[model samples]
Target: MATAYWKGANTKTGGGFWSSGHTPTLIAAFLYFDLAFMVWVLLGPLAPAISKALALTPAEKGFMVATPTLAGALLRVVNGLLVDRIGPKRSGAISQLIVIGGLLSAYLLGVDSFGGTIALGVILGFAGASFAIALPLASRWYPPDHQGKAMGVAGMGNSGTVLASLFAPGLAKLFGWNTVLGLACIPLAIVFVIYMAMAKDAPGRPAPKSLSEYLHPLKSADAWWLMGFYSVTFGGFVGLAASLPIYFTDRFGLTPITAGYCTAACVFAGSLVRPIGGALADSIGGIKMLIGVFIVAALALAAVSIAPTVGSALAFFVVAMLALGVGNGSVFQLVPQRFGAEIGVMTGLVGMAGGIGGFYLASSLGLAKQWTGSFAPGFLIFAALALVALVSVFVVKSQWRRSWGAAEGVRI
Candidate 1:
């Protein structure tokens, strides 16, 4: 059955992208991913109000937002394991329930302290871990030829962050940030129903691996390289997603709602381009797309460090986000090509790396602000990391092309 689906779905000519896979599952993945991402980064949009309410220090505000990223990064490995063992649909269902319950509980209990916010952030990590499940759930239904588009459609769920940025602040302004948490549950519950009804496990899942065997991919250097590259691209993209509101508010004295609007514009630019990035990678080669991604991201981040005006900084951020977003899609385009057999776990590992990158950037910016009285040092340092990633990808491209890239019969 799975073989027939695979062969039929490998539509290189007339069938087209939408016809190449299970559309219902793909749509379910996107919806799941979108809502999960909305709540996952919810703290970021609410950070200004939370900080003001709690009288949080700059570093505290940074850590409050960064906590979810770090926790999510770690949880992705666990979710990855679950996806392989129980299937992506089950994994996603379980994760969504946890997030909804956590948010509901937080809303009922009320978060009044910095510590309370950190706790809520940890709960939000499950939403962040949705990346591990949603991607594989959709990717497994499609063939190698359509990996980029399949993954891009599913992965585009990150656009949910834009939704949060757009609405959370305004809702908080009207009803208080704590109430915003409870209100978020309404849409989450609705999506939960839709996801349960729509999502289905793809057939022919790999036989469950032993615990030790699940970690087998780490033995290969290629896995590490992919993880490192994602940490920069996804890391930069998500890190900025969580921190931009704080940046706009602190630097420009914009109201929280206004800052969220600015953040939404930046995030929307990045989120909007992810599918294009994947498609570009599919056509040209993932390695080639990444080379350009790193260069543009690095330049934009460095430029952002010195932008003296809000308009200039927003412009730089949007450019940086666009590059990083494309890099996100390009990285995933290579993942299934190189690690198809282990896509579930690889998604977990790679997604974790991205989350850690976000954690680092979000936290470091806060520390930089507290210690140096400016966010410049943190931005410059991350910009340097992007360059390092660029050099590293360049160093490995030749060998990749000669090895797996050739074997896979896909543009790398």
Candidate 2:
């Protein structure tokens, strides 16, 4: 029954959002992206149980969770290229198979050591790279006027992290962390089958570009700026998503399940706001919305660094996540406006930066806890990065206004 709705998405096109684009592909992209993300950050929610079983050190836990983010960051570039060359539907199919196989193998073999977890993380990176595939698959189907909302809805799949936070720890506690890996494959396989059935490449995909042509977006300073901006917005969001469980367990002495619940609240807030952010950016302007995002994010993170109680910390984290979540939407809203032609690769490039940012934050928090006996420094430094993004966006606004005419209801 569900399959029929998706199979029929092509016939629904008419006038507005539903009519203007392929709803089936958009829904497929979201489900694929959502499930991939759930497992991509799966290690984070499982970290407490994994750490306890392995007797891992603080730094080891951080590195373990962070490995997927770094691997995902690098693979996104590869997926971006694949999307342009082979089409997003095929690219997504291949990625899904890799992830499912990787998890199934990990489950069958069992991961007992730090090294094994690291290997598993690299496999999860394939899931993370789904970012590059999912966005373009949906984005190409929509007209420019609907880019923000369309991308926002598709991109909202990042909310999958909330699912991990909500479930993994309890499952790990029940069946053991290793079993959790195998269990994850069930949903992933289900989504993969649905994705294959529902996802269709949009018409008029760009001809395969030379490798150099794909990298051309890198030559532009605007591209660099966008990458940097996303690094902070998405970086903060995902970094905390992966790290907060560890933080709660370590700092607050919360049970793993409780920590997971707390982390879910934080992730859910960030995910929920993502589409609203894009819509707001469309109404105002990406630049204007981003400027406010950076300011709020900076303040919130700074406050979090000094939060003394779990309640206070949760409040600060929620505020920071909200600002960062909105920033994620706003960044993409601008990405299509400026680089619509290169959206495929640009998504990879900017997404890579965001992943790198997540890697740094997640890893550094562990290092900070190990070295300084507090996670405060890591939070402070990232708070500083948010301020830097604020400045970068402010400086570029005038240039963007001069270059991009007021067209398509997308404010620069």
Q: Total clashing residue pairs per candidate?
A: 1, 1
Candidate lDDT scores, in order, read: 0.92, 0.90
- Worst window of 10 by summed lDDT in candidate 1: 1-10
- On the 0 to 100 scale, the lDDT of residue 69 in model 1 is 96
Tens digits of per-residue lDDT for model 2, 301-356: 99999999999999999999999999999999888878877888989999999999
* Residue 305, model 2: Cα distance from true site in angstroms: 1.0
Pairs of residues at least 3 apart in sequence or in different chains that clash in candidate 1? 286-412
Candidate 1: global Cα-lDDT?
0.92
TM-score for predicted model 2 compared with the true structure:
0.96
| Residue 110 miss distance in model 2 (angstroms) | 0.7
Task: Report the lDDT tens digits of candidate 1 across residue range 289-370.
Answer: 9999999999999999999999999999999999999999999999998888888899999999999999999999999999
Candidate 2 minimal-lDDT segment of 10 residues = 1-10
